[model samples]
Target chain A: MNIGIVGLGLIGGSLGLELYTHRQQTQAQISNNPSASPSPSYRILGISLEQKICDIAVKRGVVDEASVDLSLMSQADIIFICTPIAAIAPTVAKLIPYLQPHTILTDVGSVKKPIVENCSALWPNFVGGHPMAGNTQTGINAAQHHLFVNKPYVITPTANTPLESIKIVESIVDLLQAKIYHCQPEEHDRAVAWISHLPVIVSGSLIASLRQEDNPDVALLAHYFASSGFRDTSRVGGGNPELGLMMAKYNRDALLRSLQSYRQTLDKITTYIEQEDWQTLEKQLHQNHSDRLKFNL
Target chain B: MNIGIVGLGLIGGSLGLELYTHRQQTQAQISNNPSASPSPSYRILGISLEQKICDIAVKRGVVDEASVDLSLMSQADIIFICTPIAAIAPTVAKLIPYLQPHTILTDVGSVKKPIVENCSALWPNFVGGHPMAGNTQTGINAAQHHLFVNKPYVITPTANTPLESIKIVESIVDLLQAKIYHCQPEEHDRAVAWISHLPVIVSGSLIASLRQEDNPDVALLAHYFASSGFRDTSRVGGGNPELGLMMAKYNRDALLRSLQSYRQTLDKITTYIEQEDWQTLEKQLHQNHSDRLKFNL
Candidate 1:
């Protein structure tokens, strides 16, 4: 089976490596166990604007073929558009003309609603997906085969999405050894707005507020005293500016809703501090502590 | 030389181990190199509310002796009151009756102004200290040597603080191989309010907002989808509630100032989002990213 991956960065490159590893493992298993049925072969075709990255992906055996042409994706049985959130729609539009009717389409974008809407309108084969796994690091250099292992792979399929396409995407998720979660595009966006996008704002504002510190000495000392807590909380906020902007742009309304909800909670905490209500504040923190444990992810 | 440590939890227990290791290293050096002057023989006395923890500290070789008696600290040349912020003042008050005039006192509390004020009033030899090294884990079981290695150890001394007391604390910091930063008590509180206390509020509110989610499905999905970003950002918020409460209480004014600053920055980011000013939002995030890099902690 021919698989096409667009935009060979962290998500794309990691997916390519995972697919290649799965194919090799399956081949090994089939040879080792004669009773096992032969698994279909996989050929990964990587498409990227950076020809240099494409060359590296091919050299690293992450992809069987590398190309700058979207037309090459026409031969693929399935295509994963791993572009930035803002670029997903345009990339889908560009690839639609070149894709076969039977070709299965998906994405690894953080926000799913807009991408799902645009792709569902253009191609019935598209199933919106988001692999809930990433690091502070980016680019092909940060990519690894185990990136998606044991991670949550969310599939957001609308009523218009075909069952066959959803199943194809599920099979790919199985190969990646990721736990699959099915939800609507709206649900996926809202959930991500709370868990993913909201944190970027919270963390970004934290460091940005430090920048606003009028006392240079205090600001300097803050930098010196900033430890694991500050580093961890501000990790996502200090991520790629373009990516942060894209998440804000693509999921603006949902993110705004999250911010509003977040503001209310923050205000509540501030009020508790202002009123010297340590009991209520401690109770609230305890509840949040218990709730955070429920996430376990 | 005798060293006393109160509250044998993460900070205190680790300090015990570090002191023990340093003494052993110095003894080894004295034996190997006759040219070097012999260092004073050392003893570590650990005190805790839990007798089991005290026993464990002794068994683990974290301290030379463990005692439930506060009077045992009278034999110490220096004492590190590594208690909670709320307990620091009272602990110092209780220990003051049993402390020797020459026993230099210090603390590992997160907040400093209140501790500095209370301790300096009761004990002329007290030097306010906060070691910026901790994990999400707490208690003696989580304690390990080298916790303070290369970590920031801030000494907040007021005008009334004795120079000899500061030097005593500096030698201990040097033994731990931790970097020391000197500031006033007010400055330390403000710096910590920004770097430490504010992050707890930001992270706790984030998880709390998710609990307020009207849609159970979205909330449930959020649990599955909460990635490393959400985990990292919310880590400190889910920490010990009593600890968070203490930080909020003792450092209330500084924390309130930090909250006001944080709210303003969050409001600005919200305005940029509301106005669809992606360029400005991206620029702010870019600046934060660069500023975060400067910390390198």
Candidate 2:
């Protein structure tokens, strides 16, 4: 079975490595156990805009074969588009002519609604996917085979999405040993806006606000005194600027709604502080603490 | 030298362990090298409101002696008031009568202005200290001898503060192998408001906002989708409720000013999004990312 992966950075490169390792492990298991059914051999074909990244992917054995041409992906039984959120739609549009009718296609973009709407129209087999993994680190150099292990791999499917396409994606999820979640494209977008995209804006604005401090001495001391809490809180705000912008661009409406709701919460807490209502403030903080604990992830 | 530590929680408990370790190390070094000058023997006396915590501190050997009696702290040459922000002034007031005239007093509270103002008038030798360390974990169980190692230990001194008091605190900083930073009381409060206190409110409000989601389905899905980014961003927000409230209480004016600046930044970002000004939004995000990187801590 041929599996193709495009944009071989962290997500794509790591997926390629995991797929290759899974294939090797399955082949070994079949040889050792005669009772086990023989599985088809897997071949990973990787495509990247950068030749250096493609060469590194090949050198690191992330992919059995690497290419700069999109047409080479036509031979794969399945393909995973792991491009940046901004590029996902355009990349999928560019690859539509090369995608075989029988080949199931998917993506690992954070935002789902727009990508699913754009790509699913061109390719009926397209399934919107988002693997809830990865650190702040990016690039092919940061990719590792175990990146998706035990991570939530959400697949957003429309009513028209074929069951066979989902099955194909599920097979890959199984191979990666990742947990699977199913949701509508809109639900995925809204959920991500609150959990993923919202944090970026919240965190980014935090650091940006400090930069607005009028006092130079306070501003300089703030940089020195930022401890573990401040670092953790502002972490995603320091992430790749282009990526942060794209999430905001593609998931604008839902993210905007989240921002409004978040503003209300901030105002409520501020009022409590202004009024010196420590009881209400403490209660609100305690509730937030409980709510955070509920997210075991 | 006798050292007293009050409120044996994360900062106090950890300080006790570090001080004890440093004393032992110094003793061992002096024994090994005859040419080395002998340092004075150290004694750590820990006091806590909770008897169990005091017992734990003694059992763990974090303190040479532990007591629930606040008056017992009078015997020490120096006292480290490691109480919560709200209790620091009150705790010092209660211990003033027990303190010797020559005894130096300090605190490890996050906020310094109110603490310094409230206690410095009563005790001539009082020096406001804030050890920039600690995780989300609290209590005696979280104490570790190395907690202060390589961490910033900021001392806020007013013009009236004695040079002798600063030198005494410097000796402790050296013993803990931590870096020492000196700033004014107001400077420390303003700086912490931007870096430390502001992040707590920012993070807590992020979690608090998610709780306002009307749709239970979306809320449930958000809980499932909260990834590493959300976890990191909301970390301080989910910390001890009383601690969060006290920071807001003591650093009210500065924190409110920070909140105002932060709200402006958020409004600016939201306007950029509303206007679909991707270029400006991207630039702002890029600038924020650069600013966050500048904080080496």
Candidate 3:
């Protein structure tokens, strides 16, 4: 079996490394055991637009082979398009001709509904997969082995998607050592908007608000006084502007609803502070605390 | 010289341990060097309403002596009233009769303006001090030495505050190995409102809004989908409700203004998303990212 990974950034490079390791281990295990099936041996082929990334992926042993040509992916039984949200559709379109009759294609985009809608219509084996793992740093340099260990990897499959395609992607997720979650494309998009994309907007807006402080002295003092709370709350907001924009663009309606819902929650909290209703405010805060505790993830 | 710490909570207990260590180190240095001044020898006397706390503090070598009686504070040349914000003024009022004429009094509270105004009016030697160091855990068991090391310690002094009192507190801050920033009580409150308290409100509201999601599937899926982004952004919001309430109560006006500013920022971002203005959204996010990078702390 030949595995293909395109766009060797953080996610793609990490996936290549993990898959290669898993494939090698499986082959060794099959060799050691007489009853084990040795027919389905896997090899990883990595593709990147930049020759530097392809060279690094090969030098680092992230894949068995890497090239700058899309045609190299024609031999791949399965391909993971690990590009940014805005580029996923275009990248898939360019690779369609390289896909074999038995080829199954998946993606590691953050947003799913739009990608799934566009890709599943274009190819029978296109499965929308979102590996919910990332880092502060980007590119091949930031990639490492076991980056997706124990992280949630959501596969948003439409009704038209073949069961064989999902099963193939499930095996890929298993190779990466990540937990698998299955949902419709729309449901996955909305769920992520609440837990992932919504945080970006709210966190970003907070720093933006702080930037509006006209008093230079207050701003300076704020810098000195800011501690763990501000650092944590502002982390996602201040990360990856292009990614944030893509999340907003692709998941527009759900993100807007989240922002509006968040606005209402803020207004209610503000009113409690304004009216000096300490009891209600404390009760509401207690509720929030408990609600957060319900989700350990 | 003697140092007194009232209330054996996280800050108070940690202060006791650190001060005791510093005092012993200085005494050792003076004894070892014949030329070093030995006149300003210091001892730590810890007072707690609970006799159990006093006994533990002494047993743990957190202080030179421990007592339940306020009269023991008479020997305290400098006293740190490290109690809850609501209890600070009342605790100070009770400690006044035991205070010597040369004594310097301060408290470690998050919101400084209200406490400073109340305590400074009642005590001639009162100085407002806020040590910007804490943990999620509370009480004496959570306390450890070096908690204040390299942390910001804000000293807010008014026009009426004596230079001697400010000097005394500054020395204590030095002993804790903390950097001190001098500001008015109101300025400290306003600055923290932006950097610290505002984050609590926004973080808490994000979780609260997620709790309000009517669709049970979406809510359940959100929990599964939630990752580091949600965890980080919601950390302070799900923290101690009483502390959150106290911050809201003590710094009402400033917090209200921060909430308003945050609301406007959220609205503008929401409009950008609703209008599908990806350029403006990306620009705003880039601005937030750079703004956050300006302050390393």
lDDT of 3 by residue, A1-297 (tens): 899998899999989888777777777888789688663578899999899999999988788899999999999999999887778889888998888888998999988888988887788789999888888788888888889998989988888898998998898788778989998888888899999999999899899999878888998999988888999999999998888988999999888888888888899999999999999999999998898899875
Better of 1 and 2 by lDDT: 1
Candidate 1 reaches a DockQ of: 0.79
Per-residue lDDT over A261-288 for candidate 1, one digit per residue giving the tens place of the 0 to 100 score: 9999999999999999888998998998
Q: Write the per-residue lDDT of candidate 2 for residues B1-297, one digit (tens) a residue.
A: 799999898889999888887777778998899788786587899999888988899888789888899888888998999888878889888998899888999999888888899899888789999999888788899998788888889999989988898899899878888888999988888899988888999999899888878878888889887878899999999988887888898899999999999999999999999999999999999898888889985
Could you tell me the lDDT of residue B141 within candidate 3? Answer: 84
TM-score of the A chain in candidate 1: the value is 0.93
By DockQ, the better pick of 2 and 3 is 3
What's the CA error at residue A162 for candidate 3, in Å? 1.6
**Pairs that clash in candidate 2:** none
Q: Identify the runs in model 1 with alpha carbons over 4 angstroms from their true place.
A: A1-3, A20-35, A38-46, A50-67, A73-77, A99-101, A134-143, B1-10, B24-35, B41-67, B73-77, B96-103, B136-143
What is the overall TM-score of model 2 with all chains considered together?
0.90
Candidate No. with top TM-score: 3
